[model samples]
Target chain A: MVEAEAELKRLMLAGLAGDAAAHRTLLAAVARHLRNYYRARMRGAPEDAEDLVQETLIAIHTRRDSYDASYPVTAWIYAIARYRMIDHFRRHKRRGGDHIPLDDAPELFTAAEDQASDARRDVMRLLDTLPAKQREAIQLVKLDGMSVKDAAARLNLSESDVKVSAHRGLKALMKLMADAGP
Target chain B: MKTDDLIDALARDPAPPPAPPAPRRMAFALGAGLLLGVVLLVTFFGMRPDIGAAQMPVMMKAMFSALAASVAVPVLLQLAKPGRPLGWRIAAVGGFVLLSAGIVGVALIGGDPTERFQLWMAGAFPWCVAIIPLLAAPTALLLTRLLRDLAPTDLRASGAALGAVSGGIGAMVYAMYCPVDSVAWVVTWYSVAIALCAVLGAFAGARLLRW
Candidate 1:
């Protein structure tokens, strides 16, 4: 574990120096650790765990400059991950209606182990909450991995409209997932 | 999106323009806050008219707050980054406060018993407390905004440090206009004002510093 932390610290320092490849590698390694961290706590809610992993990765990426060199990289990463979890719980508790009582025998629900498909399904589920135009725009441009121009042509909308729709859709999806806590 | 796809997109995105180091950024915030405080001071509370004769007291008062601010800046900078040990920084702050307390204690012991009330109240107590925080607003806001980008883990402590720094700047600026000459009075009332800022910062930090 100490060696792994040293390696992560090395990659993080390199990433801080603008090495995109090292940053990518650091984030991937962090994601694997976050998966286990959240999975153990989230139990049956693998989708929620995956969402948290993604959210934490985004935070680590955006806030990478805040990582100081004098400290262990794992401690910094753990602090950020812990903050996200606290935020997740706070948001869920505030929403009140959909709060999952994870401490109360979360194992009662069959633990879904196939997280890749679970994540795919989760994305689809979140996409379903958007308006039809936005839903289609995101589906074509984001999920299907089509260019904005191609998605615009397919949806019979202008390219800018497709881009705007996809942007708004993603923003809305993020809000939805933030509100939909487990 | 799949987690892998998200990672790919994040990694492919070009790095953001590098931020100035925490110390430099904090210096900028302090400088800007002081400028705003000066503007506010000139507009509302004009400098004391007997400025030439009052120079000694004003210099002493300003030095007191300025030294506090100097100690606080390093601590605040450390707090901006996660996982940085703050033992020495916090100790420095504590030492500054203890030194101030010692000065006040010495003044009380050496001075007349009849003057004790004057030393504590300083006649301008209300103005001191109110104007210091009013002056602090600019620095406090700027420091908090800077801290949001820095991703401080201990939000309340970071906020308190920034607040104390801002309060020091506020008190320093206020010293220029303040006519009071008693060191004990300055220490007592100014410390109260700075403590108020710290409390306010703690509450504000808990709410605003979350990322």
Candidate 2:
């Protein structure tokens, strides 16, 4: 990563200083980098990656003056790339398609807070396949953050019954997640 | 589009972007804005009534505005880069500290506290609020144009920073022409006016600065 950044910086500085060959070299390098970047995330959707790469390249061409020489050139390039990716997601969402973004800001991959929420949603969807009593017991005691006694009171069952249902539900959920994985 | 063809197309001579990088463009935009602000101040408002004789308080207001501008200028330059953390806490906290000092100074002068508060709230407050945004219009437009094609990851924050610097310049120019000399008034009301411009700038920049 460091070497790539250094090479990009050198090419960018040379390009900015009116080196046409170096400028072409910089654009080609960035395009190659962006292709790998979008391809890895897009997976089965390879066409989207190509489109994103082209949009990103166009942005880089026009917005070259926005680059600050004090910082690494890769930072500016990636920032533009990230914005284009976000816009891509927005367009896809608007078209009534949903996708799990594989990575968030490649360089500063901070694991977006929404990832945890998405996992919770997936777990809940899996939980719906469980028997009704078990699902309710587990949701009350686990998902709702309720005590066993409180869950039993709400379900009109004994605490031990609630515990038994929850334990059985968790065992079933383990199987469900494993089965859904493939 | 094929990567090779696109790259070859980009490699053409016109591919090299225009001169003056992001920092220099921002500097030019702000410099031109400040000059225009000064000209507007001289033409519209004129200097304060006691320019030659009233030495201490009038000059002090100018000093405060200058300090405000000094803090905001570097912040503006730093925020031009995409994804940079805006360390604006110091500028905000420092401005408040300066205003507090002025308030205390006003207290030390032994005026009636209630009446003085009313006076500070009343005198030139609306005009200060009105004029700073008016002055900031040209700066905001220039900064937006300069930033139009650039990738500012945090659009609103960049706009706010630009607005803040413009507001500081506006305050400095307004100080020259303002009739009210009280430090309390300038610090409180002028700061409010400047803050209003910052908010306006942030809103405008969010919509205008998108690539």
RMSD of each: 9.0, 20.3
lDDT of 1 by residue, A65-145 (tens): 788877898888888887778766754442323455768445334333333545565566556546678999989988889
Which docking band does candidate 1 fall into? Answer: acceptable
lDDT of 1 by residue, B1-211 (tens): 4777667766765576677888888889899999999899999998989979889899999999889788888888887877677878889988998999999999888888998877777655457888999998999889988998788878788888888899999999999898888878888888888888888888888778876
Task: Go through the candidates in order and give each one's DockQ.
Answer: 0.28, 0.14
Question: Which digits, one per residue and each the tens of the lDDT, describe model 2 over residues B14-60?
Answer: 54336566677777887888789878877877778787886676678
Off by over 4 Å in 1: A41-46, A97-182
Which ten-residue region of model 2 chain B has the weakest summed lDDT?
Answer: B8-17
lDDT of 1 at A127: 62
Task: After the best TM-score superposition of candidate 2, give how far the Cα of residue A108 lies from its true spot, in angstroms.
Answer: 39
